[model samples]
Target chain A: MSRLFRSVSLGLFLCLGLLLISWWNLFAWSVVPVSGADVLHAFTSFNDQTIAHRIVLDLRLPRLLTALLVGACLASAGAIMQGLTRNPLAAPSVLGVNAGAALGMALVSTLPFLYGALSTSIAAMLGGGVAWLLVMLLGSTWRVGANEHGRLVLAGVAISALCAALTKAVVIMEEDQAAGVMTWLAGSLADARWQTWQAFWPVALISLIGALLIAPSLNVLQLGEDNARNLGINLLRSKLLGSLLVLMLVGAAISAVGSIGFVGLIVPHIARLMFGQDFRLCLPVAMIIGALLVTLADTLSRAVTYPMETPAGAILALIGAPFFIYLVRKRTL
Target chain B: MSLSAHQLSVGYHGHTIVKKMDLTLPDGRFIALLGPNGCGKSTLLKCFARILPAMSGEAHWQGQNLHHYPSKQLAKELALLPQTQPIPEGIKVKDLVAYGRSPYTGFWGKLSTQDHQIVEQMMKQTGTYELRDQLVSELSGGQRQRVWLAMVLAQDTPYLLLDEPTTYMDINHQVELMHQLQALNKQGKTIITVLHDINQAARYCDHLVVMKAGELKYQGSPEDVLTSTMLKEVFSLNAQIHRDPVSGTPMCVVED
Candidate 1:
């Protein structure tokens, strides 16, 4: 209980610190750099016609929220995926959910009428659902019982490759839509509008709540299917519900900020390493750590090449890959 | 009856391993299921545990169909210890055993006072109370088996089904485990175990259910079931069956 309190307090502090940093970054480095005082004034005076206030309120705050939501959603999704599949490498991107969402967005851009943010979001969700279904089907079919973890990884890799190729094909054919999607595909928070946050928070909240609700089952599932079954866990229900929750999370994240990679892949592992392997602790800690990591990455993306934004995905991958390699070598997973 | 199966056929996809079989296990008896490899003893046990769907018929505990009972309800009544389960890493023995209270606990999986008491009781009963704080991954095979059995016992079910519960244990630990199970059985819990060792089954089990090629060959007291003729027919081996002076139970010695 003290450990739980300590971890929770630690997560809360980190999140609070990250929140301040995110808020400060929103105003400090933008098209027009605004002072912290002005940023504060902007929050106090919402109706202020000052350009700095408008920039802080209308532009950066929403983007910051979007990044935080994406980070939390993707990270939680990855953690849940890792738990369900019992595979350390499992994540939204690795399992092809993000790529499927990207493909969905690409396909939606092809349609002459369904080009709105909502339509694209729905399309991405459907695509993610399809990909999740495919991965599950493949995972189950190729499952050799003992080597199921390996099979799941293989299926994820195969589906991710397939979806990436198809998304590329779509991008290559549509030159007009390419520019709009290019930054998104690389995973940027630049286009995060208020509407994006409006659409995103609900999905993120629902998935987080869903993750908490099913965390007990996930913990049991880590014991393997037979033990979980004897312990009264409905394996099919947990798997299906978990998959659906992950799909929603990955779909919402991709729809909001394109496909931010590695946050989903590494945040869960980091959380587990810091806090124990129990999903009850890991899930919530992963959320806070995920939010911090992406917000930090976004800050780095803004600052690293001042006046020119670097994609957050690239930044996350730079950090995540080395950590992943370290974890693999250490076999901590 | 504690548990029974009627016209039960269990198998893998598109293949029936255990044909239409009927079994009624008497209440509070320590029973052992003995059969040759691939003779469907495991499959039958799995079917009873509701891990596998019955290919044709139904299984029941008390008066309710096993399938009809909610998973938690069934879990409260029956606990199955499979032959092998992948041990999760970084889990303390106490935490792993606490999972047995999942049927009774709420969504958060917090152990109430009673739940904690039961968990402690089970750990003590299985001789794993001292190892409660140790990581499951760090335990030896016998220690691990006992811990797993502790988890099963923590399930607090009236009926326990174990598939080769003593597989990884040495003779000493195996006998200790058998004695622990005997204590549990004496406390009114019905235990149905599938064993590879005929002698061990005969010594420990009050009743024997022998199978050959997915069919029940004999079901009775060990003295009636462990006869030389039955052994020859079921195991396809000529064996001398003699009572041991110690326990006076039937012992099989294979003839060259």
Candidate 2:
């Protein structure tokens, strides 16, 4: 009964929070006062008569939706990865997927030939795939026992560093393209159009669904590989499917918002602390918390400096880094 | 035809651990595998549980090869309790036991009424019902071991393989666990355990397989296998084997 109450209350809270962000982004426009008629017009039709309607519908709505989707994707991916690996610190940033995506973007920006033909979304997916492939390869090669959490972590660190170096090399060669590279790397939702939403929405939705579907298997996996196998879970299959889900979530998220860090790392931990570690509950709770955090962060980024916007990624780091340190010190991790 | 291994050779990587060992497990019997550390008892049990691929041999459950059956099907026939490690921080005892029902669950893995009933019955049988809602990490060593046992029982298998179930347990807990295993065997569940204590193994097991240096030193009833010479040969110790007062099973006392 308490579990039901808690879940319902969490659902209510998530709905309220999402509504609040949606209202702030829609009903309240900064450059111009958005009257009810303008808001109605924005929803009913798109036109040049009301510049406010154009900004709200064309500009802000997609950005807000992107934030919510990307945030949920990263957080859900992080939760699944942590559960599958039985490690608290598992996230896309720590696992080298973000760095790999950045590398892919950097390469695309530098090479005019590739940038002219290939889309950023495809390039980002390729980069994430390569990074995960390397991690898996290195993981298999270690003489240490399979499913050693520490080995995967170490391999992630090595791969991330290598990717970072390659990104730096690209940056050095193409100093003229610094502005475009810097904006993407720092991550901004400033230009999130309908096209961007269309590109990533299906990928993120499928991955989230996949993650939730495998939540039960992850519960079994947390008992450790031997015990999970004894319980008839094919450990290799579970691990592979779990990794694929992570790749889709992280890959699509990075492509949309350019490597938003710490949402995956911190939101899942917060959800675990609030709800117990059962993935059945944690996955959805993590998704809601993630969407709330990013939406709130984006709102704050817009509100704090009014005219000059702050990056949502930077705000999350500023807030999340200290909270993460507190969790480490408290040993609640 | 209950459970047996034929010419079973087990290994890790390229190195062989147990070589061409053949053994049969009697149904509804309490069996113990006794060996010094690194004698491959754990490895052999892993082979029996199908956690490790046999290097070159066959393990049969009933008359069928264990490898030929699906993992879920095998899980319904035999369950294993591995050496207990730290439980994840906030898993409730009931949930932990429910993991044992993984093989029987659907894709969504909701606990059916029958699964819940069996889980409750297993908890009650093992005296862990009181700790059902408590997090596993909060339990004492002995209590935790009982919870693990309950989990294995929840698998609803006829045969159970336990690897050093009492490794970190206190003496009282060890005795309690042994009694529980005895009770389980009495209820027609076959139990195979690797035990470090020769006297305890002798006291509880109906059959004993003594191992040394990746080879079986002896296999028979406790009375046939628990000689002072066998003890010195396999365990490298001085001991005297005597009959227990209560159970009349062989009891070993090391001579100082």
CAPRI quality band, candidate 2: medium
lDDT score, residue B183, model 2?
91
Task: Write one digit per residue (lDDT tens) for candidate 2, span A1-333.
Answer: 989898788778877977777667665436566765676678888688778888788878898899899889989988987887777777887778888988987888687777756667667767877986797578662232466656776788899999989988888888998777777777777667899999989989998999999999898888877788889887778888988888889878888888788888898998888887888888988998898888888877776787678788888889877875665476543
lDDT of 1 by residue, A240-261 (tens): 8998899888888888888888
- Per-residue lDDT tens digits for candidate 2, residues B1-256, read 3888899888898789988888887888899998999899999998888888888888888888887778888888899998755576789999999888889989788989999999999999899999999999999877888898898899999999999998898888889889989998899999999999888998888999888888888998999999999989988889998889998988888999
Model 1, B2: alpha-carbon shift in Å?
Answer: 2.8
Candidate 1 chain A: worst-modelled 10 consecutive residues by lDDT: A141-150
- Candidate 1: tens digits of C-alpha lDDT, residues B74-145: 889899999987878889999999999999998889889999999999899888999999999999988999
Roughly what TM-score does model 1 have, to 2 decimal places?
A: 0.96
Report DockQ per prediction, comma-separated.
0.89, 0.75
**Per-model TM against the reference:** 0.96, 0.93
Worst 10-residue stretch by lDDT in candidate 1 chain B?
A: B60-69
